[model samples]
Target: MSKDYPALTRDIAQYTGELRKLVPETMHSFYALSRAAGANGRIDAKTKELIALAIGITQRCDGCIGFHIKALHGMGASREEVAEVAAMSIYMGGGPALMYAADALRAFDQFDVPAV
Candidate 1:
């Protein structure tokens, strides 16, 4: 469903005090399907990060862009992988994806490395 993402995010965040609270509950079917996609599949976490990156780019979600970038790094995705996802997104989602993709790249560069 097409939505004004900014308004949806603000409305959810306002009610929940944080966006994460709205994640699982808001898209139950999608969440279920996502989990199912990994069941005994060859698809790896890094690939999933790319998918998430594309979704964030399409959705223009700043928080999701940052979160998925962190997820990519956690799954050992290199900068090149993140760049590839951004590149792929532009083809499908057009110019708006660039802004969100840029935020993802910036977050990847700026976020602290987790302790080993």
Candidate 2:
């Protein structure tokens, strides 16, 4: 079955907000770590997002795949670029990664559509 990535991310965000309220200090630290990791240095933001996407695929985390793909889409990542990252993830992670990689590509396509 196909997933509604946009809706999935939205639901995740809603729950994440609740989690943040319960553990504001931890959530705040996590946010800071995320920001610092994603910050541009030698690597650009787009490339960092691609790396995150690949990691998400390998880890088989649907929420990570959805969020990272959405970020890549917002950064103007091409389908080809996402596919290349998926390929790399599959190579490193074998069959399980292959499944999540496909989901990641699906997430990319989902984000590609213009909202009506």
Candidate 3:
């Protein structure tokens, strides 16, 4: 079954806000590392987000799936692009990955993105 992605996104935001308050320095460090990882290098930010989305499916991390899908949506990734990444995840991870790929696609479809 797929998750309610809008709810997931909202919950993540709330949880992150609370976590930041609890450990602001660690949270800032984590955010800095995340930014560094996503910075333009051999791969662009959009590609990195797509890779993160695929890995989230492979790893079956619902929170990771929500985060990366939101990032991909914000980056203007098409549904077809998400599908391609999902296909690769399925190929790499087999049946279980297929299940989470469905979840990822559901998030991609339902996640609320702000208009640019």
Assess every candidate by TM-score: 0.64, 0.97, 0.91
Please provide, for model 2 over 34-77, each residue's C-alpha lDDT reduced to its tens digit, 9 standing for 90 to 100: 99999999999889999999999999999999999999988989
Screening candidate 2 with a backbone cut-off below 3 angstroms (N, C-alpha, C), the clashing residue pairs are: none
lDDT against the true structure, per candidate, is 0.69, 0.95, 0.90
Q: Candidate 1's residue-wise lDDT over 78-112, tens digit each?
A: 88878888888888888888877776677677554
Candidate 2 positional error at 8, Å? 0.7
Candidate 3 structure quality by residue, lDDT tens digits, 67-92: 89888888999989999999999999
Candidate 3 lands at a TM-score of 0.91
RMSD of 1: 6.9
In model 1, what is the error at residue 89, expressed in angstroms? Answer: 0.8
lDDT of 1 at 76: 79
* Model 2, runs deviating above 4 Å: none
User: How do these models rank on TM-score, best leading?
Assistant: 2, 3, 1
**Root-mean-square deviation of every model:** 6.9, 0.8, 2.3
Best by lDDT: 2
Task: Please give the lDDT score at residue 54 for candidate 1.
Answer: 86
Q: Highest TM-score: which candidate?
A: 2
Alpha carbon lDDT at 110, candidate 1: 57
List clash counts for every candidate, in order: 0, 0, 0
